[model samples]
Target: MATEEKTLVEILEENNLIDLAKYVNYVSASQAGAIATFSGTTRDTFEGKTVVELRYEAYVPMAIRQMKSICSSARSSWDIHSIAVAHRLGTVPVGEMSVFIAVSAVHRADALDACKYLIDELKASVPIWKKEVYSNGEVWKENSEFMDRKLELGKTNGSCCRRNVKVETHGTKSCCGAKVKVADGAAAEISTSDAGTEETI
Candidate 1:
């Protein structure tokens, strides 16, 4: 069971750039000609205004599962050696890293290509969402960018949801106790037995 699952999923409460680079170093071997890594960070400004901080939220389980699936998919599609992906959550200030993707292969071309695809697919299919906070207001980045490609892949693969995991309308309580509603009804309510009330999904 453990072997079937990728061991790269991690919760990064701190900076991702360093850890990501570290992971990249760890995954790359001498057998590989090249190792590629991409890191995304919060900029001080966007569209001509000073940016403050950014908040990221994700459907945790689904996001991690999707990342693993992506790595597996890339491995199948390309001649990749090893892959590691890490994304940061919670409040991130300007210049803080947001996401990291790395891929190593025997050839530089495959490594670069797979790395690009990994980041693009991560942005498009993975269930992670980011909120950009600016001086004036905040905006939620569209989740639609990844939907079409994911659906197409689902059709090719027969389904998007992995085995034993069904996509439905569900809500999840965040680590901070905030409830996030899922349109697919696949989320579940998480509450402690000692709590006064059970949070609704």
Candidate 2:
């Protein structure tokens, strides 16, 4: 299958609910020995403030492009089968999922690792903005991962990211974690990460 067919990316319209089963089944394949998933839901509170809902907005074309790039990055680091990523727009009430990712591979490790990479990259690089509505008021929010990526980019001048085995990209100007040294038109990537370690990017 082509890349378009292998990877499913969607930005749900307003008032639409993400069908978890649809995504779960999308990555299911006979060759896949493992299917890993991640669901990001809105909680009832943040910093002790009661949250009414989460509002999201994104540049759909750019978001999809970035998501596809992230999926390709995951595949570059691991042996993967298929990837499906979805995010909600408009409003997301507390306890409802706002973002979801599903990845499949031949081994548990590959699927698990790719799933982590997909969500992390989506947060770090995708052109999605969020707002948190509290019972009293609403405030715009920026993901910590997104902020960290900005810091990382400021520290480097090169383009094209390659996340390292440690899940920390060095010498990379890109927001997505990747150890790429772009000097004199040369670049390299660090593939994979320590399974025992938690994701940082």
Candidate 3:
């Protein structure tokens, strides 16, 4: 079985900005033919509200773990070379990047799709939460897409796939939609289905 280890996941400290080039450079590989990226920035407005900024928080340890699992899942699903993901904490003004992702692969399709998957999964499942601050007030927000994904998971597999299940090395806990193998100092993806009854990393 083939495995990749070139993955970088970081939750930036308070007031630290995301370095766009750092991640892109990390994923740059000689064997890679394509590089894809996604940047989540705070917009100036939301639903007729004048936004001032956005604030983010997270359980740092678990956030990094979940991010690694997500990257591992992408590697199993695509032929990718390297992956990089970064998320910002603290106040982020409008037009500033809050999240950035970079993916490199031997083909454009792999990089493109993996890039999309990384951001989607991060937004939906990561421990990091965000609050939107408007001119009038501020409120913590949840991703609606994540809620939808949870409903879908409930309809198909059990709650294990959608909720944050503690991943055990040899124990009987599953993961978020992917069969993750926790071994060799990394979380590697093995399969995508049968997550309800089987033990996933």
Top of the candidates by lDDT: 3
1-201 in candidate 2: lDDT tens per residue? 322227877767555677899888888887787999999999999999998787776555555667778988898999998888888777788889989999988899999988988998999988677777777766666666776796787843323222221322222121222212233311122112221111112
lDDT scores of the candidates, listed in order: 0.62, 0.69, 0.70
Q: Please write out the lDDT profile of model 3 over residues 79-130, one tens digit for every residue.
A: 9888888887667889999999999998999999999999999977776666
Q: What value does the lDDT take at residue 44 in candidate 3?
A: 95
lDDT of 1 by residue, 73-124 (tens): 8888888776777777666778777787777787889989988988988888
Cα-based TM-score, every candidate: 0.68, 0.74, 0.73
Cα misplacement distance, residue 107 of candidate 2 (Å): 0.5
| List of clashing residue pairs for candidate 1 | 124-146, 168-184, 168-185, 168-186, 169-184, 169-185, 169-186, 170-185, 170-186, 170-187
Q: Candidate 3: which pairs clash?
A: none
lDDT of 2 at 13: 51
- Please state every model's RMSD to the true fold in angstroms: 9.8, 12.8, 11.7
Query: What TM-score should be assigned to candidate 2?
Result: 0.74
Better of 1 and 3 by lDDT: 3
Better of 2 and 3 by TM-score: 2
